[model samples]
Target: MAATFNGRLFLKNTAYLTSTGFKVILAYSRTTNFFYAYYVLRTLTAMICEGSINCLALAYVADNVLERQRTSAFGILSGIATAAFVCGTLAARFLSTALTFQVAALVSMLAAVYMRIFLEESLPNGENLTQPILKSGQDDHCQDGDLSRKAPVLKKIPSIQDIIGLLKSRVTFSQAAVVAFFNSLAEGGMQASIMYYLKARFHFSKNHYADLMLLLGIAGMASQLVFMPLLAPHVAEEKLLAIGLLGGIADALLYSVAWSNWVPYATTIFAVFIVCVPPCLRSIASKQVGPTEQGKAQGCISGIISFANIISPLIFSPLTALFLSEDAPFHFPGFSILCIGFVTMIAFFQSVLMRGPPPVSSHKISCNSLVA
Candidate 1:
């Protein structure tokens, strides 16, 4: 069943690419450099939209799948993503000379074709499609007995306040938000600074950076496939987050000392595990809610992640400047990542202590569903 869904998604992806490719081709010969820049911006915006749309997809899936199996299903999706990233990174590293961006364009074209020819809607039939209010209020109670039915007038898009209100109710969101904040802080800084670090410390070129990313991608896939699912059910989400934070911190702490040739290779391997943890935590977080709430839940989480992305870069820039010496071989991004890990670890522990176990079911969720 999961395979079929994946095939359909591939088809959809292909179809989108094919159509976009033709449009890009037509524009390429006719457009100026400024037009190309606009095109790039447009493309990036579409990518952001696609990411938001996936949150909806996860919500839809949660609605259809039973709770017992949802975690494994999410694992399957993560595994597939892991594999794709590995293939993409390896291709980028080795075949990039031959497989330019044009190759990616071609793949997209193929996916578009497949989607147009074969894809069908996966959303379950005969379910309430209406949007509902997430806030706690008697006035928000349903008119009819069908809670699955959406509110008569849906908000076209989620508002900042609406998203914030949702976060206030979910323990999972609170914890995940903290982890995301630090992880992304570390990541955004690391990404922004790594090339500089490499140039100064090891005199790495573009090719070497590509090679490193390819290796990291390999480790990411391995951890997603072999480690995450195996470890997930055994430990609660909070513990997994702590472990992930610790691993990331460990990588950072080692970075200053790992100047040897072999250290990069070894740390890159560990980085995969560090990188893979967030999605695992996400899978578990989404699972805590009922299917009816998955879409809203994911949207709320996405908002938090976006908030973190915005905050991380700003916070890291000054810190990096303050701590990193002009001539120092190693910089502060590693230490910053370590700090983020420690902060997240503390947050996770505090969250665990404050929230005990999640309630068997929230009164709000139970009552609202009943009214709907």
Candidate 2:
């Protein structure tokens, strides 16, 4: 809610400030003769606010949902978010930026109200949510601590040592973390450049971008809702991860080299497979640890993704700006995008090294049923 409110205010302020010729000096780079000012201010106003929610939501699903059913649950979650994105994009097409943001703020406020009123706490009465940070078998010595009692206050904020311990303890966890980092890096780099590339190459307007996103959202929704549930149970998550990475690599390559407007639309075929990546990775990561460790595991994955978000723009944005400029040394305008595809290939190779978790069995009988 705060993000939405702040975003709306920022948009309004930016318009007013720009119209009034107001600019703040962020930096004066001597090498490029660049005046990096207003854009930096604009970026600061729009913060990444979804990290905590994503971590908490995935952790909750991991804790409560049956292991065998987690992929479908996560897929459904992704589908719902995609549907919401479609709706939001469509709405934004017709609405002014300020009004659109205002509406978003209002929607977020309502969502907060609803969650507060209806959402139930997932943790059990005696379970200390904070205790799991240290109790998740990451450290053999930590396990010696009393499980019946709450964790020490210091344990709530996980130390660097705790994270290092997790990374060292589980090979699967480490592999999943690598897959997530490179996957997110590729995604972020693509997002940072794609819109600008489209606008520069095809002279795309807002409606054109909206149409593209709509198609992607529909493809993603179909894959998550229909294909994922059917395929996840039968296919190994590791193989699915590899397939998704391969699809992403192709998608990025296609976008980078697209000569005609229709080529971008054609890449929607790859979206179906690409959308499967996150759920597969999440399912694999979730299986790497016991129930007590779900939060920590998912939190680590989310943290890696956040780091990718930071690193991606730094690497891709300047590359994109350089390649798109008339002063570019190379004639290939798609060089930056090709780099993104290559980054995705790195992730594909990482996925290739992963061993799938053993198949789960649902045929075992409970003790009460065995007695009967």
Best by TM-score: 2
Model 2, CA-based lDDT: 0.70
lDDT of 2 by residue, 301-325 (tens): 8889989988999999989989999
Model 1 has an lDDT value of 0.55
**Stretches of model 1 off by over 4 angstroms after superposition:** 1-35, 38-40, 43-50, 94-99, 113-156, 288-290, 317-324, 327-372
Which pairs, if any, clash in model 2?
none
Supply candidate 2's per-residue lDDT for 126. Answer: 24
If scored against the real structure, what TM-score would every candidate get? 0.73, 0.76
Give the alpha-carbon lDDT of every model. Answer: 0.55, 0.70
Prediction 1 TM-score vs. true: 0.73
Per-residue error for 9 in candidate 2, Å, reads 29
Worst 10 residues of 1 by lDDT: 1-10
All candidates: CA RMSD in angstroms? 6.0, 9.8
